[model samples]
Target chain A: MKGLLLKDFLMIKGNVRSVLLFLVVFCLIALEGNDFLLFVPALISFMMFMTTFSYDEYNKWDPYAITLAVKRKEIVFAKYLGSFILLFFSLIITFLVALGIGIYNQNFDLQKTFTLLLGCGASILFLQDIVYPLFIKFGVEKGRIGLFVGIFLLSFLLGWILKNVSISIPQDIYSFVVSYLPWILAVFLLILTIGSYEISKKIYTKKEF
Target chain B: MKKILEVKKLKKSYGDFVLGPVDGSFPGGVIVGLIGENGAGKTTFIKSLLKILQAEGEIQFFSNKKEDIGVVLDNSFFPEILTAEDIHKIMKNIYKNWDSSLFFSYLEKFSLPKNKAIKNLSKGMRKKLEIVTALSHHPKFLILDEPTSGLDPVVRKEVLDLFLDFIQDEDHTILLSTHITSDLEHIADYILFLDKGKVVLEETRDVIMDTYGILKCGKDEFSKISKEDVWRYSESRYGYEILVKDRDKIKKKYPNMIVDKITLEDLMVFVVKGRIL
Candidate 1:
């Protein structure tokens, strides 16, 4: 598993110039008070993680990797581990940049910034939980198309719900839910990520080279 | 002799193609040549043994640990963007016994640039790199699928020499699948021929070359030969050619007939194209 992680990092290292360029560009844009500051880094990190799958598919590496003295589940776990590490680093870097920009503009609200970063992190995790299993089952190319369609449908459903449904909540109940929202979201994301990992492992173990 | 690999009733099927029910116990310290035409299940058999594909059967390895086996597949490898140096680093972690010095020595001997990505290297160079990577771990068993396909004659000979050197310990074994039968004639101790997923013939090089013969005779002359001795026969404008199992016996019985030694290529052609008795 360590070897697999090293390979993914080395492959990502090949594109270091582009990654740095993107980070600098996004930082400059965020300094202009763009609301997309958190989203940009999160999306960039996810895309970087997806490129590893593309490289693996292009090289047909899985069959050869299977011949190595490693378990099938380890291979799946390694990908998930790589994603978490990438997201962790991205979260830290994005938070620092947001903090610097906020301080420079004289409106550095630590609580607001922390909450926004947490939401961005959770969104990225949710995207991974949904797409990793698709990639495992249908491969990167087909899975990418599937992801686009899934996102479109999900947005359409959300839009329909917002326009058609209205729920009245008491002021006390709304305040309680908002106060505990982060913890609730964290627990939900954890369960979903675990379920996704198990599903991906099952797909991989039964897969023929 | 100790068996390095044993397979019993191993089988895989997809669509219209089915790969085995293959049974064989390959001995250590010998190079076994697997020969067949296109779509003859050579790759499937190799993949099954490696567990790269799901198959139903019993497979036992004397070493028991996958770390002791090395593999060089024809179509799959590291991403083309990675350099040879990267492969060394990655493999060092993957294989517990990977020898970096030996790997670099092979790269130097092959004149492969450690910094160059795989896409920049020529096909032959890429093949040499794969072979060296497989050998660097000092594995007891090597499973090679067309490891010599794109190589020049000189490089092929050099790689063949490496295989010879590897098996000197008498605990190492190699199973090589190739279209180049001539290479097998030079280094292979035994030949396992597959035709349409079935093992048509398996024998030692000496026995195959010395005992199997092609008898050239006219129709009238061929009629006198025993049908039981002939494996297959083909007729041409000039005469009829028959493949016989015991050449010496046929030669002794028909002193006037011409019975010539058979090569692996000739044997494959006869078995695949010749009419059955």
Candidate 2:
């Protein structure tokens, strides 16, 4: 696992300058005011994460990786863990940004902002659980289409709730759901991530080169 | 002699192509060359042995501890964007016995630039880096697929010398799959010849060189030699060039007949592709 992580770090290191540049440019534009900018770093990190898969496919690196002292299980775990690390950093930066926005507005509400950021981060990480397993089962080229479909569904679902469902709910009901929905979904996705890991292990173990 | 590696009925099939259901072994302290034609399952067999591909077989290697066995694959492994320095860091974490000083020495010796991205390096430089990385940790058994394929004669000779030097230790063994039979002629102690999916022949190199011969004689002289002694033959303007499996027997039977020396290239070409004339 250590070796795989080291290799991935080296893999990621080469792309760091570009990814960080994306973050820097998008971050400045975001500062003017757009909650969407918060996702730019996480999204770029996610794409960077997928590039590692392409690298493995490029020259048959995974089979060679296995010949080292590592196991297939460790390689699967590293992908999940590396993405988690990326998301975790994205959130930390998001948290600092949220705090700055709250301070500047002077209507600081820590609980409300944290819940929104947590929910957004959790949802992206959740999609990764499904998409990563798909990536493992198929190469990144096939998985790319599946990822976009999932993203469209998420957007449609969010649009529907905002346009139809949320408006119909009573004031108290809206507050209650908003206060607790992120926690509930976070727990659900955590269980699903475990399932993803198991499924990925089965696929990766059966894969020949 | 104690066996360093052994395979029993190893087999792999992909659609129309099949590899193995063949068997062979590498006893300790020798270099074994695996020679075959283009479609002859050389890469598949090597990949199967490394467990890189799923295959059916009983294979016991390096006492079943895979880390003690090093491998040089035909394709690239490390990401192309990373430099050799990055690989050094990655390998330090991968192998327990990875010797940085040794690896660095090879980098300097091979003239491989330390910081250049692998994508930018020429093919020969990339190959040297791969071989250097595979050999950095002192492995008991080494397996290489087409190790000398694209190299120029000079560097190929140097790399072959390095491989020959690697086996100076009595326990070190190498299983090299290559089409360049000439490379093996100088260093290989044994030759494992594969045709189609099966091992057509596996014998000590010295023994094969000493016993195998190409007999060149016209119709009258060729008729005198018994048919059973021939492995394969081709009709030539001068005569029939027959590859004799047991030159000593023919030499003894026809005292006046010249038993010529056989090159590994001639030996493989005859057995695998030649038709009996």
Candidate 3:
């Protein structure tokens, strides 16, 4: 597991210069915006995760990795671990940028801005959960359709949540729920992430290369 | 000799193309070559043995753990974006027995630059890098899938010598799949011939080279020999060229006939052209 992580880290390390450039550009833009700050880093990190698979597919490394003494399950786990680590790192960068903006703008809405950022982060993660398994089941070339489908579904879901999800509650209850919504959603995403891992593991185990 | 690896009733299928029911074992201390024509299931058989593709059968490795066997695949396993030093880091965590010093030594011997990414390396260099990676792991068994395909004659000879060096350890064994029958002729102790997804013949290299003979004779002389004695044969305007086993026995039976020794390439052509003789 450590080895797989290190392999991915090194692979991603090659893109660090571009990634830093990405951060600088997005960070500057983020400082001038609100919840939009979270969007750039999260998307870049997710795209970075996706690019690693293209590398894997181009080189046909999975077949070679399977030839190693490691267990089939560990190979699957490594990708999941690497992607999650990326998401987590970018999540921090995104959050810090969001906070820096909130601090800059004296009229900051902690509850609204934080919740919006959390929603964006959750959507990106959920997309990763689906995109990764699709990539694993069908290689990058074939999985491209699935990726498009995933992106469409993600956008549809985000749009649905923004417009259709409305609760008719008293002011006091609404305030209570809205204040704790990020925590509740965090736990929910954690469950989905585990379920996603299990699903990916099952598919990966029976896979040939 | 100890049997280091074994396969029993192994098989895989993709609609019409089926590979296997292959069963053979590599003895503990020798280089074994796997020979076959294109689409002869050579790659599939090795992939199945490694469990790269799911197949039905029992494949037992040297240490029971499949990891003890190192592989030099036809394609580079690490991303072409990675350098030798980068792969060294990746492999350090992948294999328990990966030896950095041995790996670097081979890299130097092969003249592979450590910092250069794989994409920049020539095909011959990539093959060399794969071999270097496979050898440095100190595996008890090495599974090579066309490990010397792009190499020059000089480099191929040097690599073949390296395989010889590996088998000197007594515990080391190799399963080499190659098109270069000449290389096998030089280094392989055993040859397993595959044709249309079947193990047509498995014999010691010496037995195939010394005992297996081609008896060039006329139709009348060929008819006298039993069909069971002939592995394969073809008729030409000149005469009938027959591949036969038990060279001494045939010599005794027909002292007037000539029974010339055969090479691995001739054996493969006979097996595939005649295809089940």
Q: Which number leads on lDDT? A: 1
Q: Over the stretch A80-105, how does candidate 2's per-residue lDDT look in tens digits?
A: 88888878887787777767766776
Q: Give the per-residue lDDT digits (tens) of candidate 1, residues B1-277.
A: 9999999999989888888889999999999999999999999999999888888999999977889999999889998889999999998988899999999999999999999999999999999999999999989999999999999999999999999999898999999999999999999999999999989998999999989999999989988988897899988999989899999999999999999999999999999999877
lDDT of each residue in B149-231, candidate 2, tens digit only = 77889999999999989888878999999988998999999999888978888899998889899877887988877778777
Residue-level lDDT tens digits of model 3 in B1-277: 8889988999999888888888888889999899999999889988998888999988887687655788987664898888999989888887888899999999999899999999999999989999888888788899999999999998998899999999998789999999999899989998998898988889899988888888889978877877788888877899888888878888888898999888888888887786234
DockQ, all candidates in order: 0.82, 0.68, 0.68
- Lowest-sum lDDT 10-residue window in model 3 chain B: B268-277
Could you give candidate 3's per-residue lDDT for residues A1-209 as a string of tens digits? Answer: 78878888888888999889878887777766645557778788888878889998899888888888787789888888888788778878777777777778765666666666677679888887777778889988778897888778989999998799885689998898878877878888899888888888898888986
Which residue pairs show collisions in model 3? A69-B67
* lDDT of model 1, residue B121: 95
Error of 1 at B260 (Å): 1.2
Docking quality level of the chain pair in candidate 2? medium
- Choose the strongest candidate by DockQ: 1
Off by over 4 Å in 3: A99-117, A150-177, B218-228, B275-277
* Candidate 1 lDDT score at position A91: 88
